[model samples]
Target: MTVRNRDFYKGIIKKMLTERLTKYEEDGYKYSLQYNSCTNSYCLYYTCPGEKHWDGCAAVEASEV
Candidate 1:
């Protein structure tokens, strides 16, 4: 989805920080968010909790405005 509103993303970041939700589990998978200092952005990571390896893992980076 495309979001033009910067406040929307900021709100999500704020909520995540307020809740201390750097990592969480949902639908049997673990999701995490990490900030990249060099890029000045956040990346959403997902991986299967049952997996022994890093297979099927991926990250989605939020574009900076």
Candidate 2:
């Protein structure tokens, strides 16, 4: 990811946790919470608006929040 992308994601993550939000969307990116049965926990999932496939997808484990 580019430096801009990295910073954007980091900022979103920080705001999400601070505001205790389950979902957030900004600047063509969407972040949401999903359950991971294998991990037996919830994770934060984000998707870049224009990306295809998983190129712009990522997850943040609940523990990381």
Clashing pairs in 1: none
What TM-score does candidate 1 reach?
0.49
User: After superposing candidate 1, which stretches have Cα over 4 Å from the reference?
Assistant: 1-18, 55-65
Candidates in order have lDDT scores of 0.55, 0.62
- Candidate number achieving the greatest TM-score relative to the actual structure: 1
How far off is residue 12 in model 2, in Å?
A: 1.7
The estimated TM-scores of all candidates read 0.49, 0.47
To one decimal, what is the Cα RMSD in angstroms of model 2 from the true structure?
4.1
The 10-residue segment with the lowest total lDDT in model 2: 52-61
Candidate 2, 1-65: lDDT as tens digits: 33355445556767876888878878776677555778755555666687644344445555554
The residue ranges of model 2 lying beyond 4 angstroms of the native Cα positions read 1-8, 34-43, 50-56, 59-65
Question: Mind giving the per-residue lDDT tens digits that candidate 1 earns over 1-65?
Answer: 12225464454555566788987665566556688778767765555657644333233344532
